[model samples]
Target: MAKRATVADVAALAKVSSATVSNVIGNRSGKVSTRTRQRVLEAISALNYTYNENAATLRSNKSNIIGLVIHDLSNPYYTELIAKINRQLAKKGYATILACSDENLESQQSYLHLMQRHNALAVLLCPTWDTSGEHLAAWHDLSPTITFLRPVGSHESDFIGIDNYQAAYDLTRQLIADGHRQLAFIGGSQSSRLRRQRLQGWKDAHEDAGISWNDAHILYCSSSMSAGSAAVMQLFQQTSDVTALVCYQDIVAFGAMNALHYMGKTVGGEIAVTGFDGLSDAEGWLPSLTTAEVQIAVLAEHIVDRLLARLEKPQEPPSVTLLHAHIHWRASSHGDVDSSHAR
Candidate 1:
């Protein structure tokens, strides 16, 4: 097998010192002559040499690596957001180190430690359910961070996420306008702030319309397609007057739709369904889902922008940016209003 090329080989071919070569490769060649930089570049191409990023980071005490930690990678909404973030970071010559916490606090803490040990540039965290304000404050001491999606208990870091209350309120009002008085909420535990925010939105819509909300109609379940489907079946076994279901996520809505099909119920006809997060799968489902479309690419850009700004000026006060989600009306919910809100 042939041995791989190294920086030394490039330097030998270019007839320049190793330091000059490092300067050229690391984009610190402002002092070096352009002629010498061209020669080093030509030699690098000729020798097919690639810089060892790890070694470079150790020498300069800097990194082009960012950590991206999320609760669940299986959710398309998060994976799509990750892809957008990766694209934006790559443009700045940074790489992403992804970690899935699976909603486990211990696993998230371990990943934070790993990021610190690697001297990562920054972290874009979508924290788990059990993550507390103290954990975020302690982790920030180790490395700069930007939180998204799920809110940390305290405001210690830059935060970017959808306006859950506003989006859910808009969705619930659309359902109410469509003559859906008997409404149910599916997915997410009662302990979740996100769930509570959405539930409050549902109540807000009911109150605005002079309709009394029923606690019995609210269902608590895991944020999974299977769990959603099972929840629907279970709901029907006890009662059968639910005219609409406002799901916690697109995946959960998909599950409920599956259960409805199995139960010989007509979606968008007898029972309306709505979902959060306009994942790509939602559009292609049998009956296209009526969902709140989060601006993922825009959100990713803001996350990267905030992290880079913090990296440049760490002493600046932490801030929060809550982006709006637009409701996409479709056959699933038989909704006709097209609008959005930011708060």
Candidate 2:
């Protein structure tokens, strides 16, 4: 059996110092003559030499890799965001190691440890409901991290998310303007900040209109399609006067729409539904949904950019970026309402 080629052998064949061979193989931060680099590379190829990344990382103390932690990869929003993140990071010559938390804090913490073990330069996280700043702070002591989608309630890191409050506010106001006096909200876990924001927006819109808010109309759901379907049943059971419903997300709206169909109700003609996160399937629903379009791709790119910027300048103050939302009016809501005024 032939022995594996060593750096020394490549150096001897290229007629360069071992350090030059190391520089060529590792692409270290130093100027190596192009001719010498070519010779070393050629020698390495001819000798069938394989570079040890671990050994290279030990020498440079840099992994050139980023960790991406998401709560639910199965969600269409996260899936689309991850794809955009991958494309943006690839353009910067950085690779991402992705982990799904399934909205479990313990699983998310374990993935963070795994990233630490791999010497990740930085992490981009979409934390679970149970995640706290202290938990993130403990990890921040090990390396830099940026939170996305959901904040962990820590000032120790950066954050990027859509303006949930404003988006929900505008959507609800649109429904109100369309002659919907009795409005209902569905699909949100009581513990979610995003849910809280959207719910607050609903309240705010009602307050601005000088209409009394109804606590009974707000449904706390488990943030699933099934939960949304059940919530729709619950809403109708409790309040028969609700002419419109605002969902926390498109998937939830889809479920509620399905329930309405099951109950023999005409969606656009009798009742209206609005959803957030302008999901791909929104346009295909029985009555095309009116939704607040979050720029998922733009958010992904911004998060990556912010993470990289922090990597380059760790001492910089943490940044919190909130992106605006656009409303996509469709067949679900009445078309006569002036949607142009929606923020």
**Top model by lDDT, which number?**
1
- In model 1, the runs with Cα more than 4 Å from the true position are 1-9, 29-33, 335-343
lDDT of 1 by residue, 145-227 (tens): 89998897778898988899999999998788777777898888877888888889999998998878888888888878999
Clashing pairs in 2: none
Candidate 2 — which residues are off by over 4 angstroms?
26-30, 335-343
Model 1 C-alpha lDDT versus the unseen true structure: 0.88
What is the Cα-based TM-score of model 1?
0.92
**lDDT tens per residue, model 2, 254-309:** 98988998998778767888999988888888789999987778888889889889
lDDT over C-alpha atoms for residue 169 of model 1: 96
RMSD of 1: 4.2
Pairs with backbone N, CA or C atoms under 3 Å apart (clashes), candidate 1: none
